[model samples]
Target: MRNTPDQEKELDESPLTDGSDELYERLSLKVDKGQEPLRIDKFLVQRIENASRNKIQKALEAGMVLVNNKQVQPNYKIRPLDEIVMYSDKEAHGEEIIPEELPLNIEYEDDDVMIINKPPGLVVHPASGNYSGTLINGVAWYLLQKNKELSEQDLPRWGLVHRIDKNTSGLMVLAKTEKAVRSLAKQFFDHTVKRQYMALVWGDLVEDSGTIVAHVGRHQRFRKLFDAYPEGDHGKEAITHYKVLERFGYVTLVQCVLETGRTHQIRVHMQHIGHPLFNDDTYGGDKIVKGTVFSKYRQFVDNCFAVCPRHALHAKTIGFVHPATGKDMLFESELPADMREVIAKWRNYIANRLA
Candidate 1:
């Protein structure tokens, strides 16, 4: 939500020339001890007449507001004797579009970067069908009201470094400045950024630990999916290292590390090894496993099989050097409820069958 260069330039050229067009009312307030911080928009709403949250947010993003001479985020806490300035422009009012407040799970943050625990089913950015309520939009509103400043080209992103699949839940990092963005992007491209994942796959793996080295490319038959082979023109080298954590009667829990990132690298590689992730229909597991004994125990198996909504994969760990300070940083996310439920069901099935 910071003022981009374009917005700042526009503000400087206009400079609240007419008092009639200026809607902001300047005020100073004392922050009481033990008072919880209020959102800038909420505070402004209470103080200003007929000012919508969206208007306050846009005004803040246009650099029309200052907190003690420093532009702070919309959600910034107010201390005692804090000076607040609001710059109002009628031109900006027409363009002030209010975005929805989507749910976000922010794990860690500082001036330079922020780390978020992105849950499954949430798109990272807005697309054609999904125009509102994406992570980027939320971050935009979050930053704008915080009174941060950014350049026009970087306005869409407040230092976003990389992305994960919409269906994949895990920890992701965002940059707060252009410098950090470039630094982190270079780290990812140079293969210095480490990422690890946890998955539950069908069948017991033969090896306790091993690596998968193959060339991966889009499937010839299915454009949506990727396939692996020994040779191909479009193929890119992909490597995955996996360690078996536990074994159910038919399924196994695994931890995988990526040496080279490709589209669906883990899922494709696991499927290539005859261990397609449980409930993964994209790589072919739509129907329940069938057999003579399976027919007899179909009901029991179906209950366990229904646990996973999609592929049972979770990004568990990430490591990288700090883009700004050059310090090493690592983050980890525990298994989500859905994945845990899948494991629990598998355990029950195994115990009952073995017993």
Candidate 2:
């Protein structure tokens, strides 16, 4: 997502002058099973550090509090296992980025944007203990190498329009110019970008093609993890349309097209539907959620896990309008060697069973 001369001209007259920044606020809490009933606002005020009852009430009035993915009133009673989420529009802060020289898998680049095919385990940007060796750091160095006197603050997000998880390999676009950033960010916000992911989830999906509609937000208890609220009582709306591609009795390969870009949308939605991505340790796919308990079967699954060693998900296809060219752009990547090898192993295992 980059800007061009034409894009610069278009930006001056674009109608998207207002509300270009992504709106986000988050505070999720999973009620303890042993907790007794209490007013939700009171409960949140007690738990949320520096939270005031008046502010909590205001947030509730603003429809910013959710219980189990559905908006709730301040008087709502908190129940055990109830997932609560509260959010604001204030932007979260991040560490000042530093440039690194890590290698990047560049797929396409232009004056306004760069499309990268990120490998698994490589974080997209810096955070916490990971202030260096991130994709943005490398991108900074790349720009520096090109004699673009860029600084850590030159691009707050280092031109990243969007990002994938640390362990999820995929295609991502980075805007190289402010105009491109605004244009691309608007597209993402408007849900005009086409993004598809390939995932190997546990079990055979009942339907060939369907959409998973849920509200996705942080897990009530596991602050680091996310959960899907099918009851539509808790989080922001998230939609994932999936079509079955291939099936191996115990596992299935599917194409998931995202209608909404929530954190871990595919992973959370798939898991909510009872098919966590294979080898996804975070969402409980690392364990055997399906299949037989036989020793040989266990060994076979173990081998497959070793082959991939991470969640069996890949961002395979991405389509978007170029910021500079104002033309539709589509990019696709083949399944990684690890995923391919594991799929082959499953094929052979099934075949040998028949033989």
Candidate 3:
């Protein structure tokens, strides 16, 4: 189990620095029937790759560890089929950051901009509850190591152009200087930056292509979630264009192009269209919103969830004009192993089911 960013609430903000990145980790595990009673801390150590026994104990102390939806002690024994969830917020609200040497997947970099392949579990910047071990902290460390002349005081202006959702793996370009930052931010603001995402949504879209124009704002009831106003009565103007790429009977893979990058735009827009991205828990895609009720089908869907535990979305492609060189640059990433494997599983399941 790789360390994962289980949830990112990027409402009314950039993907990377949504005003102090929030760490919202959501995890679920099903204990097998044959398992004997074991301490909850011991049980979790095996399922969560990065979770240490110490971490589990800490969670137990903080009331973050729950068994069968109820908070439990560290000594709580795991009964068969116990549902467990570990939710905690390590909020860091300091202006200063302590740099940690985190691994970075650098795709391309130059004097002006750096294109990075952000992993699924990394927050882009420091904020309340997540001041350390963020992408920014790592970048600061990397820069300080590379250039002996610069001080840590220069760390705040890393020239972040835009942000991708924490769990959304994809390409992101960061500005290395103030000039680059201004230029890239202008490009994003003008909607000239070409960006495309691959998403697996719950239901097969009725149209092969369409545009979603709505006023997206905070949900009146669920403040944690966003709602789209199609009537123009409220919210901010947002537009998303989508094209169906492949249909897997129950869920359809689609390419979403952003005309405007509002907070949670893709997730909210797709949900507004009745085709929420698969496994997006914040938007109600975690449950079996599609497919049949048979136990076999249920098992198949559950396997898919386990296969790609995060949202079925990737920042696949991004294009922009170079801020320094005045050249056009485009970067694309192949589907990650998890997304590819699950899509293949669904493809095979559909083929055999239809056959």
As for candidate 2, its clashing pairs are: 2-112, 30-220, 68-233, 68-234, 69-233, 69-234, 69-235, 70-233, 70-234
Compared with the true structure, all predictions reach lDDT values of 0.68, 0.79, 0.77
lDDT of 1 by residue, 226-338 (tens): 88875645556678899999998578999999876666778888889888887777876444543335565666556666666777888888888886788899998899998
* Ranking of models by lDDT: 2, 3, 1
Name the runs in model 2 displaced over 4 angstroms. Answer: 1-94, 155-158
Q: Deviation in angstroms for 332 in model 1?
A: 0.9
Model 2, global lDDT: 0.79
Candidate 2 lDDT tens digits, 244-282 = 999888999999998778888899999999999999999
TM-score of 1: 0.68
